[model samples]
Target: MANIFNIMDFLWAPWRSKYVADSSKSKREEKCIFCEFPEQNDDERNLIVYRSKYAYIILNRFPYNPSHVMIVPYRHISSVELLEDNEAQDIFRLIKITLAAIRKVYSPDGFNIGINIGRTAGAGIEAHVHVHIVPRWNGDANFMPVLSNTKVLPEDLETTYVKLKKAIEDIINNEDSLDH
Candidate 1:
C-alpha cells in the first residue's frame, strides 16, 4: 500500500503547480518533441523571426503570457555545457534581443526567464535546450489558472506574434545604430 501511494504521488506531481494538473508527460507528450519553427513559412503559428547563423528566436505557442519568446540554438543540443562557444554566446544574445522585442511589443512590467534541462526539471521537450523569456506584469497572477485549471491569455496569439516579430525585425535591422 505504501509503494502504491508513492507511485501515485509521483504520477500526480505536476498538479502541485496548480496551473498544470494534467500528467501528460507520461503519455510521451513531454518527451523529445523537437520543432523546427524557422524552416516553416508560417510565421504566425510558428512565431519565428530574426534567425541568425548560430541561433534563432521563436515565440512560445503555449505562452505564459502574450509575447512570450524563446531563444534556441540551431543545433539541438540538450545541455548548455555541450554548446560550442559561438553557439553559447549567440544563444544568449538572441535571448537578450528577444527580451527587448517582447518589451517593445507588450510593455510588461517584468519578465521571468529560465531553462528547464530535463523532463523531471519541467522540460516539456528535453531533447532541446531553449531559454524561455516570459513577460510578466504586476498582478499577472489570476484565479483562472488556479481554479479552473485554465491559463487566461490576455490577447490573441497571432496578434502577439505579429507585434513581436516586427519589434525583433526592427531591433535586428537597427542594431548597429543602437550600439552607440
Candidate 2:
C-alpha cells in the first residue's frame, strides 16, 4: 500500500505532453485530424499508408506499438452507425489488407482491432470515428509501462511506416494482377 501511494513510484510520461499540447491547439484552430489528414496528399508527412475508395489507412501519430495504425473512412461521422453500408464494408476491407501488410512487415504475435466510440470510451478525438489496430507480442508489457509509464518503441514510426507501406504496395500489386 505504501508503494502504491508513493509519489515517486507513480509513472511519468513526458512525451504525452506534446500530444496534449497538439490536442489543445487542434481544438482552437484545426478541424478533425482524421478528416484533414485524408485531404492531404503527402502520405509521409500525414503518416498515411494507403487510401481506398471509401477509407484509408494511416499510421498512428502516437502509437501504442511500433506499427500501430488506424483505419478511417473518408466521411466524418461521430457515431459509427452513421456510416453508409459501403463505407462499413470498405472499412473492414481496409482492416483486412492492413492486417496482412502489418503481418508481413512486423509479424506481430497478435492484434487489437477496436473503435473507441466516445470521449469517455477513450476516443481522444471523438468527433470523427476511426478504428485502431494495435499490434501486441508475448511480453510487450514490461517494466517501462509498469514502472516508468513510457513505451519503448523498438523501431521508429517512420521506419515502420516505410516497411508497412512497401508491404501494402506488394499486396495491392498482387491483388491487381489476380483481378485481371
Candidate 3:
C-alpha cells in the first residue's frame, strides 16, 4: 500500500481562512459578486446568461451542479421579502426564462430553485439575496464530488457560458416568438 497523506497541503489551508468565515468586514471589503454585473464588461467574468427588466441571470462560479445559475435583482437587497412587487414579479420571470434557456441548452431532467435567506441559512453573501437555479439529472447524485475533491463538469465553464448566453439572447431578441 502507498501513503495517501500529505502535510504540505495543510500548510497553505490557513491562507483560505478569510473565505471560511462570515463577517461584516469581509462583506464590506469584497463587493457582492452578484452585484458587480452591471459594471462587468466581460460576459465570461460576469457569467451573465440572461437579462430581464429588474433582474439578470448569472451562472454560479462554484456551482452545485452543471448549468447552475443565480437570478439576482438589480438592486442589492438583503431580504427577499423586501423586494417590490414588480421586482418580485421580474425575478420569477427571469427564473422562467433562465430555466428554459438551460433546458434548451443542457436538457437537464429537473431543477432546484431556492433562496438561502441568511448566513445561517447557507447564504454565502448574506448581503444580497439571489435565487439559485440548479439543473438536476437522474443518477447525478454521487459522494465522490465531495469525498474525493473531484467535480464532474462535462463541459468547461467558458463553453457553457457562451452557449447559454447565446440561447438567452436569442430568446430575448425573439421575445414574442418564445412561448412563455
**Backbone atom clashes (below 3 Å) for every candidate:** 0, 0, 0
Top candidate by TM-score? 2
- Give the clash total for candidate 2: 0
Residue 58 miss distance in model 2 (angstroms)? 0.4
What tens-digit string does per-residue lDDT give for candidate 1 at 74-177? 78788899999999889887877787777777788998999989879997666788888888999887767545767778788778767777888898888774
Per-candidate Cα RMSD to the true structure, in Å, reads: 5.4, 3.5, 6.5
Q: What residue pairs clash in candidate 2, if any at all?
A: none
- TM-scores of all candidate predictions against the true structure: 0.78, 0.85, 0.80
Decoy 2 TM-score against native: 0.85
Q: Which stretches of candidate 3 lie over 4 Å from their true place?
A: 1-30, 177-180
Model 3 Cα lDDT, one tens digit per residue, 1-180: 855666544423332244446345658687776677766756577788766789888888767688888989989999999999999999987877788789889899999899989888877888888999999999887655545656677887788899888888877777675564
Off by over 4 Å in 2: 1-21, 176-180
Who is ahead in lDDT, 1 or 3? 3
Question: Which scores greater on TM-score, model 2 or model 3?
Answer: 2
lDDT digits (tens) for residues 1-180 of candidate 2: 456678776666665777767766786775898888777778899999999999899999888888899999889888789999999989987887888888888888999999998868877777789999999999886777556757799998789889989998898878654234
